[model samples]
Target chain A: MVGIVVVSHSERAAEGISEIAAEMAGDTRIEPVGGDGQGGIGTVPDAIEAAIDAAAGGDEGGDAGDLDPVVVLVDLGSAVMNADVAVELSDAEATIADAPVLEGAVNAAVAATDPSATVESVREQAEAARDVDKL
Target chain B: MTEDGAAAVAAVAAVAERIEAERDHLTELDSAIGDADHGGNMARGWAAAAEAARDLDDPDTGTVAKTVGKTLMSEVGGASGPLFGGSLVFAAAELDGGVDAETAVAFAETYLEKVEDRGDARVGDQTMVDALTPAVHTFKKSIETDDLPPIEALAKAVDAAERGVAFTVPIRARKGRASYLGWRSVGHQDPGATSTLFILEELLAVAADRLGVDAPETDATSPTIPDEDPDEGASEDD
Candidate 1:
């Protein structure tokens, strides 16, 4: 199954987004990571990379052979930059979804439950949320 | 240690000292249009980067630059972590055979490219691209077209960046956290651009000091930085 990672500036926000998305995750793995390493608000590349590893079913800095494809959803600003750096640093087949983090995570979680779901398909589905209208 | 590496490390150490001294000023600039962490975050990250580079065993120019970038990536919080640090790490590869006039130009261009790629910002976005584009261009022009000496080229680049930083004032931001301020972002100096000028100033100072010569005089006239990204890669996020 495809994996989902949520990254935000706040630790609790990432975890909460992950929790909300997990409602539709089924067998899909979802991981959340954030914060400045300290207890403050910021994003770190190392933490995002660790979450990618975990989401892909691999250990930190371990062999990526056992991992699955991972899709990352991120908040604005540094979260996007940190996620990009983490994706560059990780060995997993991971890409960041250019969509709203919460909405994209939820949409990606549901899409990942399908047996035919791929990293690309899941990402496309997540990005589809960009046009979602709620009035 | 290689001379190139030693001088590069010394330049980074000088940047750390300058950032430390300007912490309040940087933070004050950020407070107007961004999260007020730019000052403290940059100071802390550069200090750590300087120490880490100094602690390296048999470091070279590329190694010192990579170490500094990696340290900034992990230590500098917010968008700057990747903007300044991650970009440097990628650009450090250009210095593998050690620093020279040609390689320094390559390093600056690569660094600017990476920052643009990561930030999705353009020269007129009122971001660091403002300062970096002109400095990198002037440095390359001085070295390649005008056939100037390295120190003189560097001095010109620093002056170019100073003007670029000045150009940031009165322009509305189209990228970074400051963009959130809309029209209010105008009239405030960009901290990232300001920091870029400060770093360039330190690099020129260190290069002159190490070369046993006085820093050459350079001119800063009207804004010479471009009005657009050369590749036109800026996205319409604003």
Candidate 2:
């Protein structure tokens, strides 16, 4: 089961997006990590690290053997910076992608729940969704 | 802070802080293909938002979102200003005065639709839409399943958002500043997508922490940060 993490500057936004995704996918295993920049919400190394710890720590079962590569989605600039740092700090094999807050949240949640989905595949789907004609 | 209002205040404060922290990095990414003002613009907009939020004492989600929207529209420059600003406005309208998980999902959907309408672009355009569209759908679907707690539901959305961000790598640009670069945009990751992912990641972390769930551990390596490259990927319009 591949893990999915959503990083945002606002904890509520992260929680909101994550909650929506879980509601959509019935049995899919997914995790959400949020890093609050506290004083500010931007992409910073420390904030990113906090997000990673939150996501990695929030895995429901802690099934390390079946752990899927974590995929991170970010909202804005510093959010990206921090997310990058989080990935680095955790020493986790993960892929980061840029996406809009609302639409990407919907598409990513659906893709993450698919059993055969991999980080690469999910990335492709997200990119594909960018083309209005395709949608 | 009222029972429901506290979350909104907290959310706005968190977003403002995150933006301030990441302003430089955003500018760096924009400098690659834009006017090199993405960070500055975002910082100014978010600073204004933070100030307004702080002044509110205690406000509802809609009020906070409106403040964010107005600040971004008035203070920020470039394409992202209107795009992000409009998104917040739409979300505020949808959220009305609520800040629950369901309202959040609805606000996101409204935000996506507005972006799509404003940009006239869809998925695979290598825009932020790529990330947002998927995440919203996933959230809606998850809610339809069972009555999972809010935290569990957020976990599912985070998963979807991660997948959405990952899907941006091979896409060719058809809109925004990257469109002029055409195929050149294929190999490079979209900055919009990157930022969107950052927002989602932050949201996930906050949600999980609120839920008191143990974080998932990973064993992956960090990504390499390349030196600032020239604007070979800049859109023709830019």
Candidate 3:
């Protein structure tokens, strides 16, 4: 199954994004990771890497599939950079979508549930949110 | 010269010491245009990196660098974490076979490439790329073209990085946190550039000490093209 990971600078933001994304995520795994691992507001590569690892696995307690493809959605600045590092350092196949966090997560979550979903397809869906118009 | 695990650890230790000592200065530079956490973040990261490198068991130079980079990527809580530490981690592979004149150039080039790619900043952006580009270019040319000893090449690279740091002082910020300042960022020295220069200087000093050679005097404006020596550690730049 295609997986989606959401990364933000705030732990709360990441969880909140995940919560919203889960509404459309179906049975697909959605992992949320953020924060500096302390009481501060920032992102860490280790945290992001772990999130990718988690998202790359099968549901709740199922056997972890090795090298499961994963698509990651990230917020601005260091969040994106950290995700890039995590993708490079992670063993699982992962790619970070260059799109807005919340909208991209929701889009990615939905796209990942499709039977034909691939990491690239899900990433494309997530990046498609970049041109989302609120008007 | 192939740096053993122990030598790489020593270099990391020296860099950590220098960064710790200059923490306040770096923060001051950042305060004028950035979030003022560069000092604390870098000091904390490098300290942890030194410790991590020391903990490795009979590791190679590449292992030491990768360890230090991973430590920094986690500890330095800002764009610098990826820009500095993450880039190092990505570039550590260049040193896996060992460090020599050719491998060193490749490592420098790869490190510079990663930093630029991560930050999306070029030479005139008044970011760390300003310092790194000149340093790597100088190191490559000095070693491959001028046939200088690695120690002397490092000295020249440090000089180039020093100049790059100075160049950042008068330029308007075009990238990173400082870019938010607009024209106000002009006049303040870039903290990242300054820190990059400091790291290169420490590397040069450690390399000189390791090679048991005098710290060569070098000027960015004038590189000494010494007489040809055949035994230099030159390898094909494939």
Candidate 4:
């Protein structure tokens, strides 16, 4: 199973989106990292890095299957930047999806939770959210 | 050269003070073109950076630079945070020791490379690259001249960054939230560019102060404003 990480500039937004998205996550790990550590409006790269680690099961050091491939969905401008930095800082294999935050997280969660999901497939599913018609 | 990281620490502290002083002005600039959070974000970020630097235990230049990068990454939200943080991270990697002419040049080159790579922004993108690109070039060129001292090279870089900020006022933004504004983004100084200029000015000021070199004031002479045709790049060629 692929893992999913959600990054938002607001703590509530990241956590709430992750919670909503987790409904479709099944066994997939979905980690939410957001805001400055001080409960302010800003993305923190360190928090994102920790999320990536947890999502990838790096903290557990379990079987190879536990270290699932990770895909990150980011909200807005700085979230993308901070996520990129987080990915660079972390040792896990991760990719950032360029898609709408909420929609992408939901779609990615669904895709990633599938038993056959790969990192690329999960990312593609998330990116495909851009075409979702909300009208 | 013997000082491990004190010079870099002081430079970052100066940057924090400068950002605090100009926070309102930067936010005002962003209000015209962005979400109006640039000033607050930068002020918080730099203050965190200064605080982070203060906690370092007998740090090296690399350590100070890396701490600043990490602090900004964790404190500043939005595009500027990552862009600036990533730049500093790479710049720290480029530092051999204390910040001198060579270290500054290396830091500039690496920082610009990381920022451009992260943001996919070009010289005329009306982002921080607009300011950093020219500043790095001027710093490198001045250092290479040999006639100019380290402080003079730094001054030239600061001047170039300020000019870059002015250049942002005339061009429509092509990146970030301001890009959504299209032509409306023109005539407003980009908050990111202004902040970049402030950072460069502070770095130069710190270096001059520590080295006992008389630094040139940033506002001593204004840079030449380019012609006012807004769509020069867009209409350059068919």
| Best candidate according to DockQ | 1
Worst 10 residues of 3 chain A by lDDT: A58-67
Per-residue alpha-carbon lDDT of model 4 for A48-93, expressed as tens digits?
9899989998877776455767999998777787888888888788
What docking grade does candidate 3 earn? medium
Question: Scoring model 1 with DockQ, what do you get?
Answer: 0.78
The clash numbers for all candidates, in the given order, read 0, 118, 0, 2
Clash pairs detected, candidate 1: none
Give the CA lDDT, 0 to 100, for residue B32 in model 3: 92
Q: Candidate 2 — which residues are off by over 4 angstroms?
A: A1-135, B211-238
Worst 10 residues of 3 chain B by lDDT: B224-233
Each model's TM-score, in the order given? 0.93, 0.55, 0.91, 0.86
Say which candidate scores most in lDDT.
1
Ranking of predictions according to TM-score: 1, 3, 4, 2
For B1-238, candidate 2 gives per-residue lDDT tens digits of: 6544555556556766777788788777666555567777777777787777778867776887777776665455445655677567656887775777677768877988877766667998887788888777766665555555555555555555566666776777788777777777676566666666666666666656655675332112101111223254354438
Best by TM-score: 1
Per-residue C-alpha lDDT of model 2 across residues A1-135, encoded as one tens digit per residue:
445577665666776887886776555444454443343433334444444444444444555344456667767554554454346446446667666654565566677678787878765555555554533
Q: Can you write out model 4's per-residue Cα lDDT over B1-238, one digit (the tens) per residue?
A: 3374888789899999999999999999999889998999899989999999988888888888888987787677778778988778877877855666787788889999999989989988889899999888877877875556777777878888877888898898999999999999888888988889888888877878887877865343323223345467448864
Clash count for candidate 1 is: 0
Instruction: For each candidate, report what fraction of the true interface contacts it reproduces.
Output: 0.97, 0.00, 0.77, 1.00
Candidate 4 CAPRI-style tier: medium
> Once superposed on the true structure, which residue ranges of model 3 sit more than 4 Å away at CA?
A58-66, B1-3, B224-238
Tell me how far the alpha carbon of residue B67 in candidate 3 is from the true structure, in angstroms, after superposition. 1.0
Between candidates 2 and 4, the one scoring higher on TM-score is 4
1 versus 2: better TM-score goes to: 1
